[model samples]
Target chain A: MRIEEHPILDFKRGREIYFYYNGKKIKAYEGETIAAALYAAGIKTLSKSLRLHRPRGFFCGIGKCSSCLMKVDGIPNVRTCITMVREGMVVEDNDMELPDKEYEGCELRKKAVDVVVVGGGPAGMNAAIEASKYARTLLIDENPRLGGQLIKQTHKFFGSRRQRAGTRGIEIAKELEREVMERGVEVLLNTSVIGYYKRSHHFLAAADKINRIVYEIEAKKIIFATGAQENMLVFEGNDLPGVYGAGGVQTLMNVYGVKPGNVGLIIGAGNVGLILAYQLLQAGVGVACIVEAMPKIGGYFVHAAKIRRCGIPIYTRHSIKRAYGDGKVEGAIIGELDENWNFVEGSEKDIKCDFICLAVGLTPSIRLIAQTGAEISFINEAGGWVALHNEYMETTKEGIYVAGDLANIEEASTAMIEGKIAGLHAAHSIKPIDDFERKIKEYMEELEIFRQGYFGERPKKAKEKILEGYYEKMGERRSS
Target chain B: MKRWEREGVAEIEDIRLPTKEQLQKGVAIIECIQEIPCNPCVDACPFNAISMENINALPIVDFEKCVGCGKCIEVCPGLAIFVVKAKGEKATVMLPYEFIPLPKEGQMVKAINREGKEICEAVVKKVRKGKTPVVTIELPAEYAMEARHIKVKAEE
Candidate 1:
């Protein structure tokens, strides 16, 4: 288990690293990525699967899935769970794979473009639209369709009209896509950026088709609008067939219209967890319980009361002890934690549940960006090792800029603004700076306004963080 | 509707149409029928029964002195207002029912608790719907104290 009292997460933190697996000296951090530093050490299958005992690694370590887990430094089967890095952390790997099969390589692409945007989601589309103003922009998406996570979002957004308040997220996504199309931005759906490298003039993007192909394109700039993935949790028997990430539940029910199960237990009390619980009710599915390890619900009070007045009880300070199942998830065992963060003896209670949805937290997908030799920093506050970029969203490498979740971890609204900033800056680099200073000021002003609301306040801090460097530059310029 | 305050509920009390002497002069009638966020009932009436000037404020009803004339309840979301007319030994209550499974006249159904739980059985003597599907149910005067919610049974 993870540490119990982290400075940032406090009592919600897992246990301190104590035990070691397979005589390997692995350390767990107070709030670091268990899969990340472990991957750096080449230890996969942190734990065994429930039924088939298949080895699982750091597949979607953003807490989106329960694939990466281990009996951390003791405390059986914790999700090395997208936690922070700490000192003297000991983690062990279980369910080891046979040492015979050769590992397969990730697919790479052959076609080249001037500017390649990673995602076709809302931020990606907006970035492509803005970048197309000056540079030849090519938008690439792994999905067959365009609209990213917003397509599964059915609830109305809560912001001003400029941010499209009172409009459904999917509608806003559609509007953004149409706007991008109107700007004549080229879109390449079902295209994934397998790898990244720094060229003399630009960056080379490798993608996979039938076979891996390298795109040696001399691009003026690159924007990474690759959005976030869902988070997951781990417990005994958590890898059962019926268990899924919160986003997986969303994709299954909201997107595919296929019912995940009749009764469900949602672990995590953040906005995503609460929203999914509400959506499940709307879809005529029964919510068994909303379990959270925190003392209070993590989402807004309004969202909590909405579920409460509807008579759904939220259990706080409770964590899953075990998941009871055979080939599929049939039930789950949850227990109350004491002040020391230890599961109380005899406190375990079993509930008949077929589906367990975990919405713990998200980690930025920055492996490809890291592969390009960009300066990567492991910021605990900003998800994981994101590429370092300046106020213009450009990285240390001149032509390559990062946007959306791949750069810094933030929500969709802020990602949209960052994408616009990257796009505008990329365009400014390629074409004449047409009202560039004025546009930047206007964009920053609008972003400031959007940052004033309740949810926007968090990103406002992140914006200040990004702008701190720019503020010094401006001060120096004024002095000169 | 005007509201009347009475002490000690749960007992049958004699009620009848008020004589001309009891009718207040020029009581400004306020109809809150919009189901939107509005608080004209508190401000327009010059009375202190309403408190919510904030958005989405539910109008507070003062039972002691409201002249039952069907006003604020008409303007509530989901049409949740009722003017209880206690005459002789019978009480008539105006309610809002918007679901497809409508309750019919003389239908017997269980009254629900505040948490949507069933509490007591109530017989609907009459069923009436106005412009907004407002159903007025007439029940025995004794039931006026026990019944707060309503639910219909499936047809046999």
Candidate 2:
């Protein structure tokens, strides 16, 4: 199921190309990902689950989750969602990794920059753009293209004018990329950061999708806008072949114009879920309904209202029990949850559907930040274990900062603002800018606007506590 | 009210409406209550009537200086502002409308309330397809503030 007509986005009319999946011929566009090609060919079962040998489908199409891992040629564990398709490439489902054998034609190089920003989504881009103004900055992303989620976001954004309110995300992404390039920030696409060396402040990176050449980047300071990965719900047959993350479905449909399925069930009623539901409908997918475990809908009422008025039913206080199908998802079992969250007896009902999208939420990617010896604490209010940082977006460790979903699981707008703040902080620490305090105060105020009112009150207080915790920990270290 | 309750959000119930004297003085009512991160309304007013001190603070309007130009109505992204001019038993309500297949002039359409529920029918009078597109609908005086959205048809 692919979208033929869209109201806002004009999915580029790209030239078609041919690829090989399991040695069989599959046609795809030149710029499409392998997962998108296979999904468009009606191949949902990407690989077998690690345990039970059951089929596993796509989730977190951004390469965060291993559900979309597959063997390309002799390579195992290659993320198919971020891997671009080429002509006649053999794609198979299996385990693969950097081969144990001796290296062949591998290029190893090293370079240094004043600042390096990882994960070129909203955070990284904004970080690079802001920091490059004072220092030489290098921005890197694993995807072949930049703009992480913004590349797939087709809806208009919400924020003040400087935040690009009412502007579609893809357009905003292009604008950011333009500014980043114009500011002379070095950007490397299709490059993944492999590891970080705390002692040397060197980060190992790899590029060139299939056969990557490795390089080392030594940075005076580094910031991570790596973003977050989607969280999956556990249930009977939850690893079915047709299940995908709400963001994963958006990646397939909005980014590649390939709909996840003809009919689908969205499993969360939050902002991502509701937005995906509407985008799914816009992509010509018949959405059955939205299911939320919470007693009330979690997303903005304006967004929920758009779909409700458009005739999509939202079932609250209900959860999925199981997904059943012989080899692929054919339907789902849902039941009402009581006050204690246990399924009520005799409330099970079956919904016929081809796919289920999990929009439960996201868990931040804090591995790199923690590996750098930065202080990290598990804060559920901040969306899981996050690197403890001050209000300047500086982590406990010197010269290391965290921004975007990696620091907190907020969406794009906040990520953009945080990235700017972090980048400014890093740059100022190195080569101080003029009127730095005033500029920083302006940005902090800008950030506060997003973190205010009833919705933002929790994060506002949480941020205060995080800062307080950081100071206390530092105080303990100094006194000892 | 819940966050998504549609009505009662950006609570405009307590906004002070213009009295007959103030109405003759040409005042515009700022019903925005939610401290959302939007200020196009505050910036769009040319009469220096609307001001927001804090970024997240609700905008305040100086009724005496408000010329009722309805510039704020065109620029409000939330679609929360409205301009009311009382007629004998009817009033003209100017609102921001962005949907496609817009109602034609003199077209009788179903008028909806803040909750998006159809309450009555209204006649479309003016459609200003400008930088900030707006449509003026004439309805009963009681629905001056109630009618915020219009349903063109059951299927559109």
Candidate 3:
């Protein structure tokens, strides 16, 4: 089903179109993704698992997860979540059978730039905006449009006045996009950076998936603002078709106007989970309840209160044991957790719902930056393994910087500040700006204000540990 | 533990409620007890009634200077602030509401408390439309402090 009305967001759909799914004709819109159109038409099972043939639906709607990979237009493994639907296009489940077709040669392109920002989220856009002031900057993203995750956020942000605290995330994305365009920052969307080659200089091999072209980019500095991926939870029937990530549900409901399910069960009670619950209610969907393993709610008290006053129950110290259904999620088994983190005996209760959302946490997507020989270490407070970067947001390897979730998992406000710091420092290193030091100090001060709160304690400590490691590695390099 | 910590419902004693004299002249009640990294309410107040030592500190409202303009209600990202005023047997409570099919003027609705329980019937007095609409309701003075939200009855 599709959401017809919402309190906050307005879905401006494109012209209606028709497509084929598994040889059956399905209605779609011109701007709708294949996965979204299919979900809206009550087709949840997109693909099946390789080993056991388990059904899998849309999980991470940002094209990060492989749950929604389907064959489109004779291509074997196209990410349907990011590919827009065309009239009369044929989309089918990936059968792992290769099609016998001649391949066309991809056009090769080569260019050099002063700075290359590798993400289009809040961090990368800000980085490009700041870096382009002093250098020839280029921004790239793997999505069809810019604003990686911000495009789906419908709530206002929390920060100081300078960071646009009262502004909504979608509006902020538009502002950043306008700034990048006005500052003459080159933007390349629908492109994925495949590999990094340490030749005479650093060469980044990128592929334009839409245009069928390859670009060999040589840059003096690279800022990897590559965001993050949602973490999955393990349970019985967890890989079912209706089990979705919290961000994935947001993308479907807010971005594409597709209702995830009639009634949903949310796992984890962090900000993401709590916010998703509220957004679901706004879309006229029923929320069964929110279950958190922790004794207390992990999100803001205001967020909890907002939903609680609306008659939504929050079960603390509870965790989902299993999701059960024939081919999709029909319900879930939840149980209470004891003080020792063990499930209480006989506390299991069945909650009837059509879909389950995982909002457990996120890990930094460091595969691209890690391939560049940047030293990464495991820091529990920073979510998981993260690239070691100094106060300037530069990784151990010179000329390669990491910001946002790639550096650590934090709020978008802090990510933007980190991107600004990285961009300013990278540009100064190339062109020697006069106000570089002053601007860096100002950004660091803003970051300090954000990290001074109770919720910021863990991220503050994690960032300190990362900076300490960065300095130690630098000291060893100097001694050797 | 406080009720807000365990059940997500702020008890009257746990929050900074307005004094009887302050309630006579409509004062803002801030239910935000957590020390989050936010300070929009501080700048949203034109009378400078809301102040915080730092961005992370809890906001303290000066009832003596507050005029109950309801400006902070719209700016607060938490939607935790409310304005309550009592006049003899009746009182008016203003809250930030963001929902479809908003209650019309003079329409009867169910006034809900912090625990999501309907305490009493209330009549909608005024509705100021904006990004987050502010709905003012009139109810018994005794239930003014408890009512934080309103539920419109489904049309037949």
Candidate 4:
């Protein structure tokens, strides 16, 4: 089920290895995740739901979702999607059983830095690269490797030359990764920021899951570029094993060279869904069709055209009613929606697809920022409740900044620009730089230019509202 | 509703069709109608034939200045640009192709239109390989405007 040849990407698989999945031997690669290897072997069901005992597979491949949690090496609740496979590794479906072994003491390490940027995606990587120039920066991410979601993106990006437009996202990630390493930014991969405590100094409690150590990091400025997580569609049998997030499918096929399924029914017509349809076709997987609830296509017309020319149908004003299968996704029933947003009766059509990909939308990962007592507000256009930040990308809380999808659910180009603004601003606050004002202005201009398109209208309004709220809050605080 | 909006297949009227003289000299036909934030085609044109009011503006090609070098074909993230040239009865249509098993030179293939319908037979004329390979196919001059893609006979 592994894609042997792809036109856009060349998957460099590691040495051949094997792992035990439920007492059955599964062939794997050295660098692949347990979930990837299992999926390639056609084992869709990774774990069962705790309450309903329903079969569950990996959703968001970046370890944001808990569907792929499995028992690995006698430890329960290990995220199989992010956990790398080893030689002769033992991986079992989550049996809802706690580990019988006693908890061992983990090594505690203390570190101090000028800036701490969370999430090593496009935003955090750029932030680290810029911040490290003026201060000692520490970039932390929960993934086993850097680049966050960029590693799986094989399509070329859109924007001006400054944003690396026309270059594939994978290449942009590599360039940023190289810059981060060359800038002397201390990177902590496979480390999750567990908690943020406000004591005499700002302390971030991070746990390095792979190394089995806890890091207490104190920094002058903190940037939460924690990115976003895919939103789930509330359709019947959504908890089924084959219902995966769009990003998860990309990780399986593009990143790990594993086919998600024989045929897929994508549930959204946004850019992600459109790009995914083309990518799936490139990977030799059949796309049943794209079902969009919106009256008009949500993604760019060109993206939709790309798939349409390839003979893929896009059904607008339609939605998946339910997915049905015995243990996993076998197919899905879609129905046309009326003007009232209700499914028209007698318009249902059953699509024969082994998997359903949900690209509905994404919500910012605001947990760690919320933990910092930052002001959070519900901005529908901003992709749900996000931490309010000013033009400099600094949140309501002093010395703390937010960037990428955490600030707003926009494209990677905007996220990189925001990261640069936040990184330079944070570094300037730590130690004033001479050309800080000029650099920030240039980045802001680039960001404004990027947001002038029709697709940028909603995000533009949302950001203005957030800025208004930020200023209002600042004024109230000053008066009080 | 326009077919492009409903089905993502641009109609003949949606774009500026090349004149016979322009087609004779060859020109890059920009099918991009949406105003998204992209301007690589403008920069990709060494002749400065492609211009945009802003980064978000739709690309406008000056057929008079364009030499149909096909530089913009690979740079366009949307793969919406194509080069068409007339040669009496048969014409060449160059487009961006990213799929595996690229059609070999001189191979006869099925010429596909915007609606994914096979219109006529074409022969692979040339292929400029890159991250996003651009392939040129020769087909009937009448179908030059319709054929946006190619389906290799061996693929089927």
Q: Write the per-residue lDDT of candidate 1 for residues A1-480, one digit (tens) a residue.
A: 112221111123334453244665665434335554454344434555678675444434333345665655443444553343456655555334442221145443355556778787767887898888777888877564677788667665543345554455667788988887888887765455656665565555544322323344446677777766655566887666566678656654554443567789888887788777866765656788878887766654434533543345577778888877666678999888788888989988787887788878677777666666666666555666667667777766566778877766666666777788888888887776768888877776766655554445555565455445444443432210
- The sequence of per-residue lDDT tens digits that candidate 4 reaches over residues A341-391 is 999999999999999999999999988999999999999999999999899
Model 2 chain A is weakest, by summed lDDT over 10 consecutive residues, at A95-104
The candidate maximizing lDDT is: 4
Top-DockQ structure, candidate number:
4
Interface RMSD, in order shown = 14.5, 4.4, 1.0, 0.8
lDDT of 4: 0.91
Residue A114's lDDT within candidate 2 is 88
- State the lDDT at B101 in candidate 2: 58
* Candidate 3 lDDT, A343-385, residue by residue in tens: 8999999999999999999988988998999999999899899
Query: Per-model C-alpha lDDT, please?
Result: 0.58, 0.79, 0.89, 0.91
Task: Give residue A214's lDDT in candidate 1 (0 to 100).
Answer: 36
The stretch of ten residues in a row with the least summed lDDT in candidate 3 chain A is A95-104
Off by over 4 Å in 1: A1-52, A55-114, A208-216, A453-457, A462-480, B1-156
Indicate whether candidate 2 or candidate 4 has the larger DockQ: 4
Cα displacement (Å) at residue A82, model 3 = 1.3
TM-score of chain B in each prediction: 0.51, 0.83, 0.96, 0.96
lDDT against true structure, model 2: 0.79
Superposed model 2: Cα runs more than 4 Å off: A95-103, A346-349, A476-480, B1-35, B44-53, B57-156
lDDT of 2 by residue, B11-101 (tens): 3455667776566434566666555565666667898888888656778878777877788776564455677777567877787665555
